[model samples]
Target chain A: MMQRPPTIKDLARALNISVSTVSRALRNATDINPETRQAVLKLAKEMEYEPNFIAQSLVKKQTHIIGVVVPSIDSNYFSEALSGMTDCAIEQNYHLMICQSNENEVLENKSIRKLLSCNIDGLLISVSLQTKSDNVIKEAQKKHVPVVMFDRIIPGADCTKVIVNEYEGALKAVEHLIKKGCKRIAHIGGPKDLSVSENRKKGYLDALAKHKIPVREELIAHCKSFEEDAIGAIRKVMNAKPRPDAIFFINDLSAITAIEYIRRKGLRIPEDIKIVGFNNDKVSNVVEPALTTVMQPGYEVGKLALGVLIDEIESKSTERQLFELRTTLVTRKSSR
Target chain B: MMQRPPTIKDLARALNISVSTVSRALRNATDINPETRQAVLKLAKEMEYEPNFIAQSLVKKQTHIIGVVVPSIDSNYFSEALSGMTDCAIEQNYHLMICQSNENEVLENKSIRKLLSCNIDGLLISVSLQTKSDNVIKEAQKKHVPVVMFDRIIPGADCTKVIVNEYEGALKAVEHLIKKGCKRIAHIGGPKDLSVSENRKKGYLDALAKHKIPVREELIAHCKSFEEDAIGAIRKVMNAKPRPDAIFFINDLSAITAIEYIRRKGLRIPEDIKIVGFNNDKVSNVVEPALTTVMQPGYEVGKLALGVLIDEIESKSTERQLFELRTTLVTRKSSR
Candidate 1:
């Protein structure tokens, strides 16, 4: 037979006090008599009593568990964000249940359903690339579960969000390239449906307009957030009659792929085609020529997203909030 | 009023059947009448019934959830392993609750206790770097919770484990460097207490012995698995009377850091200091002069670890099993 850990009831029985008195004393509730509270604490320590959070959650209707859904965990951005989230979650005495959607809408919906079934107190999500519906998230909200979106989020969703200033970040990246005397700048954007992609595209167009450079439709390509897709986009851009002198990519992964492909094509970076990417992934520093990138605060975004979600969960705040973290351009050899 | 999702009891009341009968029919139990099963399935489809796993766990004494404790998530190795674990777990209809220990023993213990309180059916853990005791793990097994260790495991624990062939992989890496005309090779290893580190160190020494090179104690350095530590160790090794001609690092992170430092000292890779690292992280390819590394099969390790754990959970297998997957040397420009 397994020896069960002593519970509150056992402490109450040993202390010859009411169960409620024991519970309140254990919780250090102000109303509990000081002597009784001390005695309860002493007995609890002597018996090595550990609180049963699961059973307590059943009574209080709060699990103190947050569910996190991400497109994938294999990216440095997501992993760093998760590190920040874990730190904050643990500090707040809450546990996180993490799930990966693998960038599929169906899997994303399934993950949400599973999290809901587990009765998580709240959710922090970065919607999948293929996610087109907010119905599942709305369903969670109907059950009074607060949802906070970060990084890749559902467009126009009535929920709190934490995101980097993609528009400004892209503008700065393109401006840096322009200052380096590179015209005919090509743009490799992410999925058209994604807000970050759309905003970055706008930034590229506006930067071109600011410099009075004509927008060449043929130089712009939308990719599916994969290295292969970026390679294909790069081939198309480089094959144009008047090839682009520079490329501003949606993220570091795409830019890195473009750099490799450009090198394979026997071109020297910055001299042949300058490159700038968003998201200062660690690989950016290690890659040859050291990629120039916009530093998105992934860790800060994650910590702040959890902060907002927990605030909503505990305070029951219904007013949707949006947090936009700033990004900075990190000049490196790729753009120089 | 909030609209609660319909439960099995509600279905039973609406269908004029007992709760147990409704449950059995919904589960498609063999003994349940065919007509009743059809009726339950039809109504369940109509009402969009999703099982409350938390409530179900209370009744069935099984959560169908696996608790995973890892040192950290901000690494390519761990993320890739988690990817594989997620793939296998979802296919097996199990959800994973992941906790990051941040390489702290106290936090690792806390994570285990938290997972235990959640009533997870099984545990998959990579013991933290500072973990010196297996008391918490033993406590879980005392309650009949099956535990499986992987990657960074307890040395002599009776639990099942899955790991890569670290010794052979290190030997191959060092031997390859020697074959490339490197006479003085330095080794930058991980924490001294870690089994993988000890095994890899032995491999390094054995490789040198096989090549008839006298062991020089000054050529080896033990690091704490951080970039700063690697930098410090590299500085010490490079300052020796006769600098090492090559370095075989414990992992890619250390190797990458060494590459950066060696570059800062105006030394060209493969010309001044050839390098070989373990764990072919994505950064290995992105880095300048792309790192040559031993592929440790993190994804396969994760998949196999979960498979063995699930087997133990289902079959109550007590025989201890140690699975060591093969590692292959991937030649790249770093060593060439």
Candidate 2:
């Protein structure tokens, strides 16, 4: 039979002391006698008694829980970011309640609703691909719960944001391929609606223009970030008349998918068609010939985003902070 | 200025109706006039008013939130499992709050305390390797919360479990190598503390005995299952006399690391050293010469575990249910 956990009262009774004295000892209150506190603590440890944090939180009417909503936990980028957040949370004595939206806007809103019901002090979110309106976000803000947006976000939303230099990263990626003597460089972009796609596309176009290469509208295609969806976009570029000799993908997963497909079709990487991608995902290093890519600082972004959120929660600040993190180019065998 | 969310009282004032009538109309109570109900619903929709779930939950004295704690969210195995849980949660009108322990015992306990503070309805945990006490678990049970363990578990704990036939899977992995004419088969195992490590090792030994193959002490080694840690374990087995012709790794991450290391040493896979591993991570298929592994069916395990947890939550019986999921051996280029 399972026995009930010993409460403060139980500890008090065992020591012939008052419940308030036990509580004071547990919290290391300044007024408690050192000897009495030591005895209470030793007995409490002997009885394997852990304070009821739930009961305390109920009386306080608050919790130190931060709600986080991301597109998917399986994605390497998001997972790395979450790990960074976890590290920071541990140091700051905060707890994270994470939810995955699976890249669906409806699920994202539902997750927000659930987090709100938890009375989360603050929220960290990366909007799903299909999110259009900022109303759900507005609802959370109205409750005075600060929200921090990262990566995929609603532009102009009243929240702090973790932004990356996607434009610069894309430019460097395309220029590297261009300097490799590639005349026709195609691009595989993300969902057309995403700011990431727009910025990267602009960078790609600007790089080609700087090199005096005509932008071929037929050479660019858009796809959702999933590998399977990317294959079609890749085919669109691969089959272009005067087919592109190089490609710049928005992320590593899609780039890896293209590599798998090209190899299956008996094509040689670099010598025939060079490829580059964004997000230096761990898989980028393990793939054959490795992948050349732009590295998004996902971990740092997560850490900094959480820091901004905590500041907002503790201070009565409505002024939003826009923090920008830079991405770097990593040249690997896929481009070499 | 942000406006307060329209409440039943606001709806009542706008419609010139009683607050009780408005609440009844919103909840679709049959006693309400159909026309009045339709009017209230239409106005509610127009005003962008959503029910305050947190308020409703307070009155109900419970929540539908389930707490989940995993070793790491970044691992492919755990991420896939989390995704499976997410799907079930969406279907069942439940929410999951996930915490990552980062494989630390203290963090696991801390995360549990935080989750308990949230008044979670049920808990699903895969214990960290360093966890040595059941006292914390027993405390939660004393509060009448159902806990379900999966993948990594505390043996003989008073809880439901999602068990896979890991021994059968390991037996198949080694037997396949034996059939391939590999006499010097090595095993790279996980932390000695994990039940998974124990069961898989037992199967490896049992398989070798059945095949009349000798198990050399030098050919067996242990690691913590992280890729970096597994490198030392791999080196130990690889340096054994007449170096093993085949290796059955505890998981895919370590197997992939070995593959990378072997390739760098100018060795060919299968021909030089055949390898098989557990948990066919997605990267297993992407690696050069693709790794052969035992499929752990993470998604199914997660879905089933959550189902079991929900059942235990609703049912009064404290009877523990041990549900078993099976693993399958997937042969790929690395072992072929």
The DockQ scores of all candidates, in the order shown, are: 0.45, 0.28
Best by DockQ: 1
Q: Against the true structure, whose lDDT is highest? A: 1
lDDT of 2 by residue, A192-240 (tens): 7668789999999999999999999899999965454688998899889
Candidate lDDT scores, in order, read 0.86, 0.84
Docking class of 1: acceptable
Residue ranges of candidate 1 with Cα displaced over 4 Å: A12-21, A28-34, A178-196, A213-225, A228-247, A253-275, A333-336, B28-31, B178-196, B213-225, B228-247, B253-274, B333-336
Docking class of 2: acceptable
Q: How far is candidate 1 from the true structure (C-alpha RMSD, Å)?
A: 3.8
